[model samples]
Target chain A: MTAIHTGELVDRIGEAVLADPAVVRLDGGPFQTIATYLPGRRVVGVTAADRITVSVVLRLDQPIPAVAAALRERVRRVAGDLPIDVHVNDLESKEEPV
Target chain B: MVTTNSQNDLRDAVPAARQSPAPARLADENGQGKTTIASNVVQKIAGMAAREVSGVHAMGGGMSRAFGAIKERIPGAGTSSTAGVSVEVGEKQAAIDLDMIVEYGASIADLARAVRRNVITAVERMTGLEVIEVNISVEDVHLPDDNGGDEAPEKSRVE
Candidate 1:
């Protein structure tokens, strides 16, 4: 298996997580701790280390656990051997206010 | 905070017949992830559902309703949909409490029942969280004559 760089891995995971319809946006965990600090920019809500952590705000249309499970599955395909931690920090309604 | 062993224990506790029909609703140990639903989301859903019932004239007690009226007049101070609705949401279940004003002549008991059913259905279906209980409190009754005071304000002496 070809090893991917940490920076690239973070981007890949971010893209994958966002592709899921249930996820509204990435969230920086408490105090903005969960993130990947790059040269000039940092990706919020995703960190790569001993274990990968991703926090997100999800839409309320689906079951929370089901969405979490799907997210982990998607991240796992990109992350390979690293364990993943998914945090669903908040939920948003699907309807738009008039 | 959920560990693999605890998930295994939960799996073992469930009846075999029940386990075969559906996937587990709770988070599993296989690194699937953890999901937390904010209480306010459930509160909003419950509030909307309660208002859908015919007899519910409004939500909240006298003081809150008065406050809500004043808040509505201010720019960018939109009315709170969750007013008079409180919810406790757990990983897999939720409980809701509602304060409501009913229209006069409506049967309180029947109205409560209808509101409870709608709230449970809406919350469970929308959020996928089991609504264990919905407690309804009828705070007041809205009389038709009561609108006279609210509809017409006293003329200002200066104006």
Candidate 2:
């Protein structure tokens, strides 16, 4: 496989992770350490180095592990052999009455 | 060489998963990556489950209840669902503590048992965390007479 640019790969991984219904949004973990800084913008919740770290706030409807496993699979599709790390920073109650 | 070495150091400093005193029950680590569930998620689930019991009038101790009341008045300052709940979550198990007010007619012991069961079931089913114990503190009972004024506002106005 052709080597992909780090910035492009990070962006693609972010998109793929968000596509999962169980994910509420990508989260910047405590202290905002889980992120990738690009030239003009930064991708929150995804850092790619020796491994890829993706942090997220998930909807409470699904089991946390199942969602995380699904996310790892999704990231693998774009990230290739890089190990993926999923951090669940928070949970959003989607069904809670306003 | 220096830059690469520093990068490695930085990576090492930040652990792949959060460091907690207790093993995180909801965080599952495997070859692909690690998935961690925050403690607050368990707290919220326990709180919601406790509230679902028929006898539970409200959650939280006196101070928090008062604070919650004030908080509810503010527009967009939503009431906290986790107000009266605290949880200790481990790698494969969780313990919950709850403060609640029961209705006047309900039996406290029975109420506690029902709330415990509901909370354990909800937390286990939703997050897949095993609930080892649920400690419920019945802070107060809601006396029906306390709200009599609201029900008979016209009587007071006429008097």
Candidate 3:
């Protein structure tokens, strides 16, 4: 199978992860600062490895473990059989304004 | 690599593409040119949609609303409709995170549901980008008496 371009692969993985209703976003988190120092390292939380690692923030309403597991499968489909690292860095509130 | 039971479970959790279809990328190709929707565009759209919902008193949390309020006071700094809205826009899909303050007495569950539906509809219709999720964060509540400008006046000084 032809390997996808790194950027393209990243985009695809992002799409897959976001496709889930429970996913909030790929949280910028602390890695946001690295982009400033490392100009081209904009795709934070995504690492190019033999397998990839993905870290994200999720909506609080769903079960965290289940969401993380689902993400692994999603990431694998887009990036090939890569072992993804899913981190639940933050949780968005499920309740409305009180 | 050593795989654990949880990893195996995760492996099984990936749904089939047909079952959970990926969002279609927004494409404008006429063999002449193409158009793209910027992330900011989606952000603004989401913000507007949330604002359109009646129970939404304001966008952003306390500090952000404070800053947004201050920004509005400046001559050229028009109110930022996108203040509380953040988006992660992709080739075919976009995800939105909103921090909002609701008017008191509104049901949180019902309002969130309405806001999510409205935001998804508005963003998808306008941008042609499928909104995968709209995460709402109810940062604060806006009480009727909380309007700083509507405070009862003190005894007339001139009197």
State the C-alpha lDDT per candidate: 0.77, 0.78, 0.66
TM-score of candidate 2 against the unseen true structure: 0.76
Candidate 3 segments whose C-alpha is farther than 4 A from its true place: A1-98, B1-25, B28-32, B67-79, B148-159
Categorize the docking of model 1.
Answer: acceptable
In what order do the candidates fall by TM-score, top score first? 2, 1, 3
DockQ per candidate, 2 decimals:
0.38, 0.44, 0.03
Pick the TM-score winner. Answer: 2
| Residue B141 displacement (Å), model 1 | 2.4
Write the number of the candidate with greater DockQ, choosing between 2 and 3: 2
Residue B72's lDDT within candidate 3 is 70
**Model 3 C-alpha lDDT per residue in residues A39-63, reported as the tens digit of each score:** 3545665554464656565664454
Model 3, position B40, has a per-residue lDDT of 56
Q: What is the C-alpha RMSD of each candidate to the true structure, in Å?
A: 6.2, 6.9, 14.0
Q: In candidate 1, how many Å is residue B22 off? A: 12
**Candidate 3 chain B least-lDDT 10 residues:** B26-35
